[model samples]
Target: MQVRFWGTRGSLPVAPKAGTIADKVADALVAANGRSFADKAAALAFVEDDLDFATGRSYGGATSCVEVDMGEGPFIVCDLGSGVRELGLDTLRRCAQEGRPKEWHIFLSHLHWDHIMGFPFFVPAFMDGAKIIIHAGHPDAEQALRRQQEEISFPVPFDWLKADIEFRTLETGREYEIGEVTVSVILQHHSHDSYGYRFRDRDGKVAIYSTDSEHKIDQMHDENDFAQFFGHADLVVCDTMYSLADSVSMKEDWGHSSNIVAVDLCHEAKARRLALFHHEPTYSDADIQRMHEETIRYEELTRDTDALEVLCAYDGLCVEL
Candidate 1:
């Protein structure tokens, strides 16, 4: 399975200002150190190879939508954050070329505004013949979606949509076949409660999407159940929205976790790779890159017999499991 991150921010969507963009350009130029390029290709190559990610590219501003592809037909999406709009546009292009039926299976984590805000702008949801099945653990998923599209909020009403949309309230802990993958949910710690999904294919490959979740210090002692849930997964996309100091002190009960906790959890689960996700909106690209470097160092310092790969998830990132 291939997992693509459309959005990875938490709480809110934010973009860099003009000053930030200028700073990146200035830094890159300084690093070039007056070197001359024969062509734009050579300069582009230098930027790609020499410049670090934070200086060369952005982490993006969208919040929490992901795509899970099993190399099959059905469209499987996770969350409906602002990133979904881009995915929706891309889906339209694919549908236009392939003439495939517009069927989407969306797995929601929770109905936070940031997580559900993209539904109104999702192009496919506005198209005829588009069948959208929103599978969520929350019974009020449809209610929340409809409420967002109310005239007071959005110009377009939910009833005005051209597509056929269905909401399926899923029972957590029960295994269900959703197209090419078998999925199961585990209740997570969050406001109004969030759900973590485990997707496993016929070949036994597993990819777990566990975001907007907080791990308590008291609960960490009893994390064997979570360990079992994450056991042997190829990739575990987790919430790492704060530093250990902040998550424990100032941001306690804020429903977010730290990269330190993420590494510890994945290590205990024996998961192969952990993608740190749900970045804090206030953090600059450099801040996130520093956090990623720090997390890698922490993982190395706390390594067991086998090493677990750690990566910071950014928009447009693709991971194969």
Candidate 2:
């Protein structure tokens, strides 16, 4: 199984600035500090230096979408945030290159705007004979899709989309077969009822995706329940939207997890690796790096038995198992 992140930001979309010197300086300061360039004053000075940015352009600032290719039949996508627009276009390009009909499956955790906003922009839905299966926890995934295509909100209605679309509502603890992969869905604690997915390949490789989940200290203390929910996965992608300090202050119960909590969950679940997702919009690349370093240090001090590998998710980042 191979997974690719199309967007990693949380809350809203963050677009790349066009030749903005301030943005360039912020990127350089972040690189130099090896952390997020949080100090606005310092970041501005770096921008004034006119640093070159061939490497910076590659890290796109799209929002919360992921694509997983299970190497069996069709492509599997997670969420449909603004990043899906690019994923859709890329799918079209790949289909054209390979000379095959488009076939894709989209699994949605919830129907939040940021997670489904890019559905209308997905180019493949306009093509005939394109088979797209939408697996989600929402009561009416089809209704939500139609809402986005309303005349008041969009220029085109849902009926205009030519692709054949199917919706399947998944239940918690039940496993569904999609080609050679078995997917297990679990209901998670989020502002809205969200579903976390576990994918087990025929070869026994496992990947669990549990984004938009909030991990409270009390909840973490209960090892039996949480471990049963996330245990023994090869790769677990989790929500790490706030630092412990930030979470304690105003972000408490904000429907997000801290990096420290995510690390502990990985250790508890005995997951081989933890890919942190749903980054706060305010977190720059440097900030994410700092969080990763802190989590690693904490894990070492705690002597986490799993020795889990921790990584921050980035747009276009791919991992193969």
Candidate 3:
């Protein structure tokens, strides 16, 4: 199983800085990982002129989105933030190049605007005979998508979308199957009710995608629930939208967890790998590096049990399990 981050910034998209060391590292990492570094570099270059490592300004844009390819018959995507626009275009190119019809399954955690704003811009919706299934926790799943189709907001209507689309409203705790993947949904604590999903392939490779959730004061009180929900997960993508200090101060009850809290959850759940996700919009790449270092330090401090390997998530980051 493989997971690829199309966009990682929470709440908004962040722009690239000119000739920054971090940008170079990011480009190098993409090349090392078999992605198109030249194209990425070109894109960054077109956006900036001066190439300073320090004193460079970091830019910001849209929210969270990710794609998970199980190497099976169908592809699975999480959330539908502005990142989905790129995901859709890429999917179209891949399908045309392979001469196959597009087949995709999208899992939505909730109907928040930041999570669904890119749906209309998604290129696949414009293709004829494309197959897309949307699975979400909203009781009014279709309504949520339809709300974005109003003439006041968009020139095109949902009915005008050319793809063959299906919407499935899921209930909490129900397990469902798509091709070789089995997915189970769990309720999470958020501003409104949200969902955390667990996907297990036939080979027992497990992945849990849980974001937009807040940990209660009795942090470990529901540990057993998560243990059962995410037991033995190979990868866990969790919400870590705040620092310990920030979370303890004003961000508490903001429906998000701090890095430490997410790491603790990974430990309690016995997850093999934990990917910190849903970055705060205000956090720069350097800020993310500091958070990553702190998370690593904490992971090492609690490494006696070897519970989980902690890492941070960035756009275009990919993980194989």
Candidate 4:
């Protein structure tokens, strides 16, 4: 199984401004001052080894769409954020090139605008003969989606869509088989509540997607049911939308977790890998990179026996398990 992140930001999308790009260019020039290279490879090597990731690359701007690849069949995705538009285009190209039927399974955490805003733009939703299954814990999931495409907001009404779209609500803790994958949902701590999904393939690879959820520091040491939900996951895609201080001090009950809390939860859960997700929207690329480094340091200080692989999720990141 492979987990791909098409978007990673929380709340809303954010693109780098012109001034940011110019700053990076200027930084790169200053770093290269009086330096000579024999070939492009040498210059590139220097940049890779010396230059900061924020100065050369971005964590990206798209919000919450993720693709979970499980061999062949219909595509399975999590959330329908702005990034889903790109996933939709890619799916269209693949379907057209291979002459295959278009089908998609979307699992939504909640109906927050950032989570469902991309559904209206999903090309498959507008294509004839396409099958789209939307799974959620919210009973009004279907109504929320339809409301987004109502005549008041979007030009195309939901009823006018050409695809065979169906919405299903999953019973918490019940496992459902979607193709060869086994999926289980768990209620999370968030405003209006959210669902965290655990997907396990036949080969025993497990991936947990838990976003728009918050955790309390006082709950970390206790034996938690949430840890069981994340147990032994090969990859735990978690909400890390704030710093530890902020998540606890000022943002209490804001329905978002910090990277430190994510590490603690994954550590308690015995998860093999932890991917910091749901990045704070106001955070710059540099801030995220520094926070990622801090998370690693914190994990090192707190880890007991097994070492967990830690990574910061970015748009276009693909992890194969």
List the candidates' TM-scores in order.
0.98, 0.86, 0.85, 0.95
Model 4, runs deviating above 4 Å: 35-50, 97-101, 221-223
lDDT tens digits, residue span 1-321, model 4: 999999999999999999999998899889889788999899889878989888877899999999988756788899999999999998778787876458899999998999999989898988889999999999999989989998889999999889999989899869988887999999998998999999999999999999999898877755387899999999999999999999889998999999988999899899999999999989999999999999999999999989989999999899999
In model 1, where do residues sit more than 4 Å from their true spots?
none
Model 2 C-alpha lDDT per residue in residues 1-321, reported as the tens digit of each score: 988899888889876556554765566656676644579776555554544333243335777898877644677888988899999998787777866458888999888788888899999899998999999988777888899889999999999999998898888768898887888898777876888888889889888888887878656775456566678888888888899887777988887888888878878788888888888887666577777778888878765465888777888889997
Please rank every candidate by lDDT, starting with the best.
1, 4, 2, 3
Clashes of each: 0, 4, 8, 0
Candidate 3 regions exceeding 4 Å error are: 16-62
TM-score of model number 2: 0.86
- Residue 249, model 3: lDDT of 80
Runs with alpha carbons beyond 4 Å of true place in candidate 2:
17-59, 99-101
- Give the range of the ten consecutive residues with the poorest summed lDDT in model 1: 216-225
Candidate 4, clashing residue pairs?
none
Please give, for residues 1-321, the per-residue lDDT of candidate 1 as tens digits: 999999999989999999999999999999999999999999889988999999999899999999988766778899999999999998778777877568889999999999999999999888888999999999999999999999899999999999999999999769989778999999998999999999998889999999988997656977777888999999999999999999999999999999999998999999999999999999999999999999999999999878999988999999998
The best candidate by TM-score is 1
Clashing pairs in 1: none
